[model samples]
Target: MIMQVKNKYVYRSKISEAKFRQIVRLFALDLDATQISQIVGLSRVTINRYLMAIRERIAKFCESESPFQGDIEVEYEVDESYFGPKRVKGKRGRGAGNKTIVFGLIKRNGKVYTEIVPDCSKSTLQSIIRGKVDTNSVIYSDKWHGYDGLVDLGYGKHYRVDHGKDEFVNGKSHINGIEGFWGFSKIRMSKHRGINKKYFYLYLKECEFRYNFRDENLYLLILKIVRINPLFLS
Candidate 1:
């Protein structure tokens, strides 16, 4: 389906929205182009073209400015997760082998944001928070030393749940939401037996998008993804 906008712009595509959606369903099944073509009754070349377009469009969509403004009020939880080699005996923290660091923030009602960071240093973690979160939103996290002194930096409320003493929750002062997401992310990654670092963020974004939109049908959801064209049109 094509929609003409402003008379001067024309959108033409071979796939209808419904068919595009079906093709997307095949992709979600972890199928390759040839496999999707056989299942969806389309040429392999056509399927490849559509898949490439989908990836670029989604990347641009992620960078698009969100309408979320103001205090951005939502229950926020912050935490860090690691990705790397299997654990061995006697390893802790930095000793847990070379791993990439990921920071996560999730809302109480179930929205999530995640990104890769070089490390969990005070500067790195705090910078991610300042960029993605509204200063007035309450920030919840575990008692990681890296998060110390956030109040000194103008946050509305900085609450910590110390896991050292087995304190998981203190009247909703916990990071269980984000931590749950971290566990989910790891489980998804295990299917791929570890992903390349460059593609890790893309996979992470896909997971966050799926988790946040779990109520939608997987087939219809991906069809909407296939319809997007990423070329910048003036």
Candidate 2:
């Protein structure tokens, strides 16, 4: 029997509607493919396909609902974090071994946006900030040279805490919000052991979606996204 999820019909599925809904609900609860397979009585491969489909929908939702429009006027925290296996021996921050660089921006008491970047150089970071953030907004960050000229680039103010000097917060100038998100993302992703580099961005986008809708009902939200954006099925 075909199941109607929101506005679309689930066709060509061997499992019943209740079982498919169970799989999707488990996925929203952050279960891995293996655990979901065991719980849903499906093969691991089938569960993996369902998980990928969910991730694809999340990616599309994030892209279509991106909050970076150069109109954010609030206390914004910005930071960069590396994601990958720990380096045995090498420089840690910035030019670390082989890790993916993710730049993040978060408005205090608001949503967050993250993007995979080639590097955290001044030029690269500045370009993204200029496009995403609004002018005359106060920006906070750690003492990274990449964030150096934000005020000069038209921000209202730029505050930084020198982490190298063991300073984390100075009055209200800190990147704790965005940094906290980095920690949260890493902890969630750790459950999967490791994701492929090729599809790392999709998983990363999923993290962003989760964080953005942390306070809302995510299962219903996922249904809404799937219903509104049929392109996600492609």
Candidate 3:
């Protein structure tokens, strides 16, 4: 339905600009579909669709604003986290089954980027690092075997925290920043009780977008992104 919005903009949507913007506001507030439907007087299904679209938009925005967006000189922290419900009793760490692997990299005091990976293999993780980070920057991580040859990748310096020996901090050799983000993401995702694996990537990117712009007015930022991107609501 290609419709004109107030004679100023055209959108392939069944929703008016005002209604779309209202939905955007509620979504920016982090209200789930039920809460948003109650406030906006829309069906839960409709609200859910809009929310899903919004998350997709947010994912695209985060991808475009990746951490190393020409700012590769600064130091960085990298880590991999496994996300899943506690299904196997007494199982801890990446050995658990049905868990999704996510690789993340963050610039110190800057933005973050994340990806749903097949595994945390050295090749998988390091390839992402090579693509996003230049060798002129310092890299920090835990002393995982996967992170063994970061300096060999031409990085200026590779510092590591030996978590196995409880050596968490050795001056600037800490992955605390990315570790903190992993904790934050787990906590936030737990609130949803559970999510389908198919949509997990969208949720992960949403977390990255949110954390990267945590200090700013997210409502406005999202609104601006939506305005330019335009909504093709069903």
| Candidate that beats the other on lDDT, 1 or 2, i.e. the better one | 2
Model 1 regions more than 4 Å off = 1-20, 28-56, 65-68, 71-73, 88-91, 230-234
lDDT of 3 at 109: 89
lDDT of 2 by residue, 108-212 (tens): 888999989999999999998888888878889888899887877888588889999999988998888998899999999998888899989998999999999
Question: What TM-score does structure 2 among the candidates reach?
Answer: 0.90
Pairs in clash, predicted candidate 3: none
Query: Which 10-residue span in candidate 3 carries the lowest summed lDDT?
Result: 1-10
Task: Write down the lDDT that model 2 would get.
Answer: 0.82
Residue-level lDDT tens digits of model 3 in 72-114: 5689999998898665887665637668888999999888889
TM-scores of the models, in the given order? 0.75, 0.90, 0.89
Task: Record all residue pairs in model 2 with backbone atoms less than 3 Å apart, i.e. clashing.
Answer: none
Full ranking by TM-score: 2, 3, 1
What TM-score should be assigned to candidate 1? 0.75
Q: What Cα-based lDDT does every candidate model obtain? A: 0.71, 0.82, 0.82
Best by TM-score: 2
Query: What lDDT is reached at residue 230 by model 2?
Result: 39
